[model samples]
Target: MIFEDMDRIVFAGDSVTDMGSAQPVGEGLFENLGTGYVRIIDNLLAACYPERKIRVTNSGISGNTSRDLLARFQRDVVDLKPDWVSICIGINDVWRQFDSPAIPDEQVMPEEYEQNVEQMILQVKGKVKGIFLLSPYYMEPNREDAMRSRMDEYVAVCARLAQKHGCIFVDFQQMYEDYCKIRHSTFIAWDRVHPNRVGATLMARAFLEKCEFDYNHGNGEVH
Candidate 1:
C-alpha cells in the first residue's frame, strides 16, 4: 500500500549517508546508496512488510557539504525520480572549519546553509511523495564548547528548513547528544565528523521513526 506496488526511496547527502558502497559517488541499484541509512531502511522494511517491496537508492557522497549537495542535486537526486527522498547534510558545513583551517566558516554559515537547503527542497517539492530532513550533529558527552557552538548554527538551519518546507525532520543533533550520555562521542565517531557503523545505524533507525508507514493506520500508532 505504501508504494502502490512500485515505490522508490532515495537518500541524498554526505559521508554519514555514504557508509561504504562500491561507487563512493552512490551509483547503481543495490550499491547506489552505499550501506548507510538507505540500506538499513531497506532491510527493516523488507523484514517488517515483505509484501511492500520498497526500492531504495543512495546518492550520498563522502566529504560533502550542503553546498556540494546543491551542486549535484539534479544528477544525483532529482533525476532519479524517487517516490521518497531524505536530505542529510550540513555537517561538513561545520566540521571542515575545525579540521581544515584554510576553509573559512563563512562558506557554510547558517544563513548560507539555509539557502542551500531551501533551494534543494524547492527542487524536490511536488516531485517526490515525501521529503525528510536530517539535522547535522555533534556529540559532546562532555559538552565541549567548540562542538556545541559550531553545531548550534547548523542544527538551527536544518530546523528552519524543515519548518518552512513542511518536511519530516530527524534530529540527529539531539539523538547524538542523547546517545553521548551513554557512550563517548569518539566511540560513535572518530574525529566527530564521520560516523562509525554504530553511529550510522543510529541515524538510520532515527530516520525510519519519522516515516509514515501505511501499516500504522490499523494500530493508531505512528510508524
Candidate 2:
C-alpha cells in the first residue's frame, strides 16, 4: 500500500541492513541485498507475487551514520531510481559519543538528525513512490547507559520526521524490545541491533503485515 506501483525498492542504513549484501557498485546482482530483512522482504515478494518484478536493492553499510548515508544517497539510492526507500540508522550517532567522548553533541543533535533525514526525504520525495522511516534502537537495559539516552533523541526525530512527511514508520526499536519480552534479544541478534536470521524473519513478518501484496501468490487476495 505504501508504494502503489511495482517499482524499485531501496534499503538504506547501517550494518543491520548491510548484512554483507553483494555490492552492486563493484560487481552485480544488486548488492546481493543480503539475507537481512530487506532480502526476506524481496524473497517473500518473489515467492508469492511472482508477477511483481520489483527490484530490491540494499545500500546499507556497516558503521555508517546518517551523514554517511546522506552523502551516498544520491549515488547508491537516487541513482537506482527507486520507487520506495527504507532507511534504518542512528546507532552510530550514539556510538560515536562513546568511542569519541570529546565529540560534541551538537554534531549529531536531534535537530541535526531531523535535518539529515528531512533532506534525504525531500530529495527522494517526488522521484519515489513512498518512504519508510525506521527508528534506530538499542537493547532494553543496555549495558551501555550513555548510549541509551543519546539514541532516544534520534528516535524521536525519526518519529517526528515520519509524521511530518506522511511516510510509513516502522519502529524496529519498539518491535525488538517487545520481541525480547517473549524471547531473548539474542534470539534475534546477539547484540540486539544487528539481527540473526530469526530477527530478520521478525522484520520480514512485520513488513509483510504492512505490505498489501499477497496471501499465497496466485490467490490474488490481500492477506
lDDT of 1 by residue, 120-202 (tens): 99998988888889888877644457867778778888888889889989998889889888888889877776777688788
**Candidate 2 residue-wise lDDT, 161-182, digit = tens:** 9999987888877777777788
The C-alpha lDDT values of all candidates are: 0.77, 0.76
TM-score of each candidate? 0.87, 0.86
Per-candidate alpha-carbon RMSD to the true structure: 3.8, 3.2
**TM-score for predicted model 1 compared with the true structure:** 0.87
